[model samples]
Target: MKTRIKFSKEGNLRFVGHLDMMRYFQKANRRAELPVAYSEGFHPHQIMSFAAPLGMGLEGKAEYFDLRITEEGAATLHSAEAAERLNREMAEGIRILSFLRLPDDSPNCMSIVHAADYEILFRAVAPEDKIAGQFVDGSAYRSLTGDEERSLRAAVDELLQRKEIPVQKTGKKGNLRELDLRPMIHALRCEDNRLRCTVAQGSEANLKPELLLSALFSLDTARPFAAMPRRVVRTELYDSAGKTLESYGTIF
Candidate 1:
């Protein structure tokens, strides 16, 4: 049986890296004596996979994972009662929101996840006293200048229509790869010192939330700043059809 678990990370736990979190969950399953199936190999391991790994220093309300169990009864271990038992043993800043059964044919959360929505908070700039103020001012200016706003919108639209938007993927060679960011960008809105956007999913065209924000910032050349203090909170995850993928409300 396959079980999907939704959870949140908060407090100091937001600093924990992906691999460490995986280890933490593995230990939790062991302590609970879950009849989780192990891979058939020399070095067998629990069959578990996260929907998406959270970036360091960012807090979010939604996160999820899918786990395969050897015995059907082990699926019952994800119940609310079992979740509470697991939470009691889990360290502070980590909370299990819910666990539910999924259809055997259901796509893996990681592969089916097509878009992620996030809200980022940053420092205010220009004449605005608050970050929100800057966002409002920028919006007003854009609205007042019809031609400029139209041109900017057109450029973004054209970019979205492309088959691929090449970006540098940092790896052993620091090579350039053609990733279609168009499918990844569902929407982008700015308010005050916060920028909210949704980008497409899948490993092939995944866009870092920060990279999207950087592109938006570069759109305006007149406003110059060395850096910005930004914090991101993932709001939701969606599929290609724009359906909510899973609830990770407790993770943030």
Candidate 2:
């Protein structure tokens, strides 16, 4: 039997890398004494897989992982009980949100995740500055102002009017290429001090919020978000058609 776990990453745990989180879960599972299955080999490993791995320094309220367990164990281990047990074992910054038993034929969580919603909170630059029109470069590090708020709003409006927003992407071999982000951005909204965006996620055409912000600000695409101070939180995940994705238990 396979079980899907929904969890949240918060506080200092946002700084933990994907690999570290994997290892942490391994230890937590062991500590919780869940009857998890292990692969057959000299170097046995747990049969577990995570959905989308959240980027470092980015928090998430809806993260998922699937683990296989013995049928006998699954019968006895209720989902709610399992969640409670895991919560007790989880570290300070991580919390278990839900535990669900998936059907035998259900697809892997990672493959189903086509998009993700993110809330980006940061201090924008004052729009009154001469560089506000440019909207990029070193001017973003400054504080926000009423005039700048209107300027940023206008920028967002202009960005949405265009059919294609081209940005540069660097390949592994250091080659730079142009990529259009307009198609990937499913939705976007600029509010008082936050930018809410939903963009293409998963293996195909992933668009990071920082990348979108960089493009929106007309910054240099080759590391435009390097020094930006911001807090990113993933609020939801969705399918390719822009529908909210539900775990195994919520499928009904």
* CA lDDT for candidate 2: 0.78
RMSD of 2: 6.3
Taking all chains together, the TM-score of candidate 2 against the true structure is 0.84
Predicted candidate 1: what Cα RMSD to the true structure? 6.7
Residue-level lDDT tens digits of model 1 in 133-247:
2321132111113343354455445555656555555565876654445556778754433456888666755778866655554545312321544457787777778877653
Candidate 2 lDDT over 79-117, as tens digits, reads 778999999998776889888878888787888889999
Model 1 spans > 4 angstroms off: 75-78, 123-172, 177-183, 221-226, 247-252
Q: Assess the local accuracy of residue 87 in candidate 1 as a C-alpha lDDT between 0 and 100.
A: 76
TM-score of 1: 0.73
Please report how far candidate 1 places residue 156 from its true position, in Å.
Answer: 9.6
User: Candidate 2: where are CA atoms >4 Å away?
Assistant: 123-145, 219-228, 250-252
Query: Model 2 — which ten-residue stretch has the worst lDDT?
Result: 130-139
Listed in order, each prediction's TM-score against the native is 0.73, 0.84
